[model samples]
Target: MLLAASTQRTIGLVILAIVVLGGIVYIYFNIRSARNEVGSEIELASNRKPYLSDEDLEGKKLDLALGSSLVLLTIVAITLPLYWLGEPGRHEGRDLDTWRISTNRGEEIYLEGAQCVNCHGPEGAGGVVNTAITSSSGEFVAQVNWKAPALNTLMSRHTEDEILHVLNYGRNGVMPAWGSGGGGPLTDQQLEEIIFYLRSVQISEDEIRSQVDSGVEAGAKALILETSDEAWAVEVRAAEAAQADAAMAVRLLGRADFDFECSDDASECLALDEANARLTAANEAAVEPLDAAVSTWFDQVSAAKATADALVIEADPSLADEGNEDDLRAAALEILSTLDAFEGQEAYLQWGEILFSNTAAAGTYSCARCHTYGWSFDGASDYVLEENGRDGPIPELADGYVTAGGFFGPNLTGGSTLSQFETAIGQSAFITRGQAIGQTYGRGGSGGNGQMPGFGALTEANPVGPGMGPGSGIVFEYPALLTDEQIDAIVAFERTL
Candidate 1:
């Protein structure tokens, strides 16, 4: 328990008062007794009288002085141990205070100084930033909102040194250099503080799993809509239009009325409430048709899996209810294979392609952000330009993407990936466990400078601390960003490209 500053000050003052009062009383009595002495400003007279004889001074008075010294010694002995016992706790609390202060300062830099929140969102829940794409010759492409990945689970995916490396040297042109080492403004210490702030905002493991699942589900739904019958697609589009309209109505009302949530029950507040209600209903309506389409797609996938049980790990039927993720993933991969997903066939390529360039998490879980040029700026979507009445802005690629013909990362088109790995499993493994800063990979694939990120669980040694040996450091297992089945699909798509 910590005392308030005022309370502590009051206590300190009371102790000071007691000590000063005691000293004043002692001096007053001593001075008052001095008047009775025969000497008055005459040092010779007092010196002439010899000190008290041994008989008078060396008995009770001497014993009392010795006893007082012994008592003080005892107090010191007791107090020193007590103070020593509390020292560790005191220092721990101080360290905690220092960490809190540093974290707050880092948060300030992230928001105001660095303005990372402009793209990464408040508290790192993820957001989008408007950026213009450019062709090789510097011709302007459409202005698009690029998805910035969430930092709440960053610690789960990256080690401290790895994150610091990125901070010092920003990711693929999207994220700019922040540290002075990369010719940016912030100092190394300040970047470390930003990382400290990131640590403070990390979400739970369950939250990470849910986020990954949601992304996959969204991509799966998009694939379903793309392949669905015309009636199904029309219904989905109509519901989406209605949802968008309701949301727009609410926004327009909110802009006019202002602060309806905290205001009194006025006319505008009632109108805002009605708009919100309509939005909620429309949102549900929109979800219904999309969910139906996705359900049908899942049913087809399930039927395929049932027929191809022997192709993969055919576990006991009873184990199906055990919720074993590995088993389920294995089954899913087998089903995809049965649908000819791994053979670079177009029939299954659409689903794999959707997974490869998934926009969920701003394509954080997908390969496109690193592998495809201008992917972040909606390079393929001309509607964004045409919708805004800006015409004739040529895309760098006449086609949507060069697939895995990489930009920030290496190109994987024209059977490069196939040549890199002898088998699909090896390629999948390499993609799942990304290259470390100086770790080697593949045939002639020298350890990259932290280029590709591991989408699956990755184990790396903790940076050796002072007095620690190479293999003695702690090992950290970064959480998987994508599931095995999802990763396999992306790998399959790359093979096709």
Candidate 2:
């Protein structure tokens, strides 16, 4: 109430004052009037002359006493059962009120108390969080913008209990543990309230699809707008075309024709060497302009993205009802979408590499944490060890560290992944559902717990009945670990390993 606008608060205060004064006056007048009426009646009775002799007066008194007793009996008979009949309804009403209060508190925690909006954004929409990359000892390293996933659609991925479990324990190093058991700030009840808030913000599947489709179209528009400059666009297209031609020229030049492995004195070997050198020089020359063009295009894209981000911020609303879809649409269409040379199969594998290593979620959870030994982070670091005082600097790995090597998890290198899964779909499925406790997965893999999180939607092993307890009417799906496209990319990358 204190945070309300000045005009609104003033109006509220005035109204409250009026109500309080009115109630006081009403009670005072009613009490005074009742007392006055009783006094007047008593005085009238005391002053009245005797209506009969002693015997007649006694008889009249007896009759009055009997009449008063009968009236009192009749009033009790009507009211007693009514009060008892209303008891159960009153209890149910109290329970409902309690739930409503808890839900409101949960919203408060999500918006203010827990500071979830810093990463998740308003109404549980995902957003980018800019923070400094720090070592385990709290030394500053570099700045990074981490991507937080949307919580509004969280139910489509995980059940309420699974979400509750995550709330209790947190994930990776990015998301701090929130429950008391994990030594965070919130209690179990408070966490539940946060979940309730999340429940209220969910959108329909049709709306989600529409938003995604609109974004794709908008992205294409932004791209065309950026590259619409005649001179720059023409230069970019020419450079790209030249690079493709150079690449094809290199491929067409057969290795057998340039076999320098033959005796250097041989005439054919000398001729082939000269030809190979000329082609290599031509390819290198073509690459230079291509690189410059790509750099310029990337800069433009970055600028466009920054503009879009600003628009998105303007559109963001704290409450679902206040959201401005027009602003969101404008922001989504700010950047240009372009065709990439590495589309189709090549793109999937490349994307997988990014997802495998990217610290998008709270700067912690990623595939490399378990699968790759010393890839880019200290795989040994865990919440349990950190709590037990095993604090140390997180050793940073050099770029292109030995990927797919075994660390905390199994080795995925040297065809090990392909051998286990047999097919890409198998690999994808394994990633989607993950391994349950003591459940066998893949070829000869066993004794696994639910350590490997699922990337797609998951079903609960056991769901509660509608009347299991309070709030049982509410249901939730297990949160997805990854999207289908993302999982496909990871699977492709793993196969390469």
Candidate 3:
């Protein structure tokens, strides 16, 4: 009965319980009646010998036992196969429940356990990450705001495994690794759940493209407003006139000369002070027209950007049914193929630079961060350190110090890349799969552990940490970080450098 309740064997147990209770009650009444019968028989046969056959009672008992065994065997034969047949459905239901629970747990970890939402935003839209800087001994140094990337479109940029690698090992000591391999805190199961949650938040490619185009259009409109307006020209001319009048006034009063000694005589000092006051007034007046022009331009640009963003939202293609998977793939491919139009153009090289330095998205997940000397960014200077293991007052780059020269990673300038890679394809491939631990890369470059992250696919497959449980040794396939055209553009830019 205890086993039945524990295992939830309800139907059979309920029947058995009823049968056992009935037998106990019947035996209680039967024993009481037998005791009365035996008492009467003993009184009647007080002084007489009884005659009876014991074989008849034994025959009746045997017959009853045989009948009960036949009934039990019949029931078992009918129920066993039915129980076996129901197992497949039960297994499927259990799996579904497990996945549902995992997804929920992942969302919780993203929001609360990991506090990823603080940097990535509530919807993973990205935001500023403000952290206090400290010395090795935990001295307060500085505070900075780092731009965190939008995870809503993360899948479009990187694969599951690539994202996992980042989660495990971290980046440049800014993003702390969360897996055990890098001495992080999260278990392997938690990492997998986070991936599941990310999959649910992905936006369509069409929407992404539309938003990008809107940004470009808004920038163009702002540029045109700055240069092409007649009102702006008038304001600039007025500002120039006022500024000249102020300069002339100062000059006539001799306030422009540094050695014009007026401290000894009271009258000379008073006159000098008056002239300085007039010059200050004129300078203040000169700024009004310029400030108005600048403010107007900013307002117009902001309004234009808002309108463009709204239009993009309204024109999103994902709202409508786009046919089969093949059709969607073809449409996406066509849009991606247009990136090649910038090939061999000057703009291509400039685009590569933007990709290398831009920290608005994905933080500073760019090549320059690893390649350039002290090239860490926090919404301020791109290069934070003047030299290794020291805080800075950075020197001027008067000698045109190579920006992409070696720092944490190797130097890409000085024709070294050209020597390593003979063709564009070879360079692109090397950029795709960065240096893994114990693995040699382009030309004679030695392996430097898993320091370099691959932009194409993950090179390290087996799980790195001990926290990974059963079936953790399998490889995680990730999506490429940069598109083929983007990689090609970077290759072109690096070759020129």
Candidate 4:
């Protein structure tokens, strides 16, 4: 049986070979058949016109094949690269690009629009919002509650690391944590860039100190703004004349030579009597014009204040008729015109009061004790012994009088305020100044210079500074830290002042 099966397998293999040979023969015959059909078509065409040679036909076929190959290769080459290049990972989002642009240190970040000019100022030098920060008692203080800190002097005092920390972590409730630690919106690198920009700011402490020290002289000049430049020149000439008159009075008064008088009754001496009368006349004549000028200036200030008050009341619906908002606006314009008439009178009066006052109060100290009050190009004032016997030159008064004892109160007479003198300067300014001074001077737990006293819980909306706000006798003995609205109101009022 095995031998019979081997024989059958050999027969099957021969048959399979024969079938393969037959299929090849059949395909060869079909190719020849197609070539014959093409030849027939060409023969018919040749019968009608000039026939193509075999060489030319072979050349055309070769060219067609080569062109098709090249076209196929080109399509594959072009598409392969394009398919790979169009992958998702290659592109980034527009927001990411925008963020990169915004975070660049050299670029200017406009918070909102051109109106940023109105507050942040040209280079962010203590804008309308931040200028209100004051130092008192060695701590950083703010007159208003929930106010942003100034960026101007921050570079001078704060380290880059500290600034970055603040930017990331924010301050109090008002300043949000802008760093990852506080779930901030900005990335760590963005925060660092901001810090770098802030650190680059350069502010002159010397210039600020000089300005603070010159408060008195600035006040004196403020008083004479109502007089025209020509009038001022005339006044100057009058002042010179007064000086001569004063000199003449001194010479004629016989008081200059009181020691030479031999009369038992000096009053009975005719020469002395005549001299006294002449001296009195000259003194009176020299002072008359100056007195008149001062009176007129004050009158102008009073009138302007009345006009401004009226306008303010009209603009406020609570104070005026709500139905006449437009009318109130027109009225405000009229008031502004009246205010313009007064011109520099308000400043002059304020400055005069600051210059001549025995005691000054603002924020936390006396201005007279720390600045000069008289006129001199070189910046010094002569000592005027007050009627009460207080004596010191302007430079002497400015030395360390306010900060000497470490807790000297500031003068607020000529400073900005919110409500009345007591509310604005006494309460608000003092609290803020005390906080800043405390931090700067190193008097608080934070451990700073300790040059001034600390406001403690009083620095915050709730009690956070020492002393619990300013003392009693003026406004509230210890008022709460000011609100943002109150601060704004105070600032608005201060700008007017």
RMSD of each: 12.1, 19.3, 14.0, 29.9
- Where model 3 places Cα greater than 4 Å from the true spot, the runs are 1-82, 132-142, 152-169, 177-196, 199-344, 358-360, 363-409, 434-438, 445-451, 456-481
RMSD of 2: 19.3
* 1 versus 3: better TM-score goes to: 1
Give one digit per residue, the lDDT tens place, for model 3 in 1-497. 23423345556455556656765787689767763223324344567666443456447776688668857855664456446445545655665576677777888999999988988887677776666555556665445555566776665545455677789988656678998877899998899888767756766555554544343334333333345445554444445455555444444445346565445364545554655565555445545554565456445534433333343334555623545433333333222223332223434455555455544444324676577643443312422332122354233322334567865688888778878876556777777776655678777879665566666644334433222334545454545556555565567667767
Cα lDDT listed for each candidate? 0.66, 0.56, 0.57, 0.39
Taking the tens digit of each residue's C-alpha lDDT, what string does model 4 give over 1-497?
23443555565556555655765687689668765324334445444766566677668787799679867865665565444433322322343353355444422432332122244344444333322223334343322311122454444333344455665665433355767877777776556555434434544445434433354333333345334354543545555455545444443445446555435364435444554565556445535554565566556644654555575784564647667654454344334322233454354335323432212112111222222221111112121222112234333334423311211222223432222233222332433343242242212223332222222212122211112223311221222222222232222333243
Judged by whole-model lDDT over C-alpha atoms, candidate 4 comes out at 0.39
Taking all chains together, the TM-score of candidate 4 against the true structure is 0.25
For candidate 1, write residues 290-323 as lDDT tens digits: 7876676666544544444434444456435556
What's the best-to-worst order under TM-score?
Answer: 1, 3, 2, 4
- On TM-score, who's better, 2 or 4? 2
- Report the error of model 3 at residue 105, Å: 2.3
RMSD of 3: 14.0
lDDT of 2: 0.56
Name the lDDT value of residue 458 in candidate 4: 28
The residue pairs found clashing in candidate 1 are none
Q: Candidate 1's C-alpha lDDT?
A: 0.66
Top model number, lDDT: 1
If scored against the real structure, what TM-score would every candidate get?
0.68, 0.45, 0.49, 0.25
